[model samples]
Target: GTKTISYGCVGGDFNEVLHAWEKEGGVPRSQRCLDNFKEAFEYCELGDLGFAGDAFMWRNNSHTAEKYIKERLDHVVATQGWCARFPAYRVVNGDPRHSDHRPIIIDTAGAAAVRRN
Candidate 1:
């Protein structure tokens, strides 16, 4: 039987808001949302399906540094069972085409993502 791989945009941020970003740019969201995502992730036994591309997946494209916002809000996650099935599986973050969120591509062509972004 083929293993299952779950992935999506997941519009909300995980854990606490990013303070490492620009000033006044990284507004923190409610901890409740973060906790919820964590609970689900653990319950499902999901792991970050590593990517090869820009560090941050979402950008506001703002000109002002203080107002600019960038974050790794999007991701592809997989379970241990799923990973065992596709040992060569990988994920690549695509350029954000006029959108705040970037596109995620699943690569199963056997070309492993060798570098950490």
Candidate 2:
């Protein structure tokens, strides 16, 4: 499956889902949503593409640690076949600019795909 898939997943404050997994701070608890989220990914056959740059991709724009919240919300994922195309698929999470959510860049800049039939 030499297919490739790339998408910018946008959901309503998905950070809550991650926090639920961590059992930490963020939005209110919602085990139902969390469970469904896990099932959804399993159903869709999607997984973490691993990432580079700042581990934290977003911040709540708060100076106080007590109120400040940072999370890796932005990400990239693909099927096993797609990942095989670029063995070195790297995700560079750029620093936040004029927005709370930072930019996401998939870096295959040095990937040299093998020619096969």
TM-scores of the models, in the given order? 0.66, 0.65
Q: Cα deviation in Å at residue 113, candidate 1? A: 10
Q: Candidate 1 residues 7-78, lDDT tens each?
A: 432223342332243113557555676667667776666766667888577677699887887777766777
Cα RMSDs, all models:
6.2, 6.4
Instruction: Identify the runs in model 1 with alpha carbons over 4 angstroms from their true place.
Output: 1-24, 29-35, 112-117
Which 10-residue window of candidate 2 scores lowest in summed lDDT? 3-12
Over 21-103, each residue of candidate 2 has an lDDT whose tens digit, in order, gives 33324554577876776676655666667666776666776777677676666556556656666676667677766988878
CA lDDT for candidate 1: 0.63
Q: What is the C-alpha lDDT of each candidate?
A: 0.63, 0.59
* Top-lDDT candidate index: 1
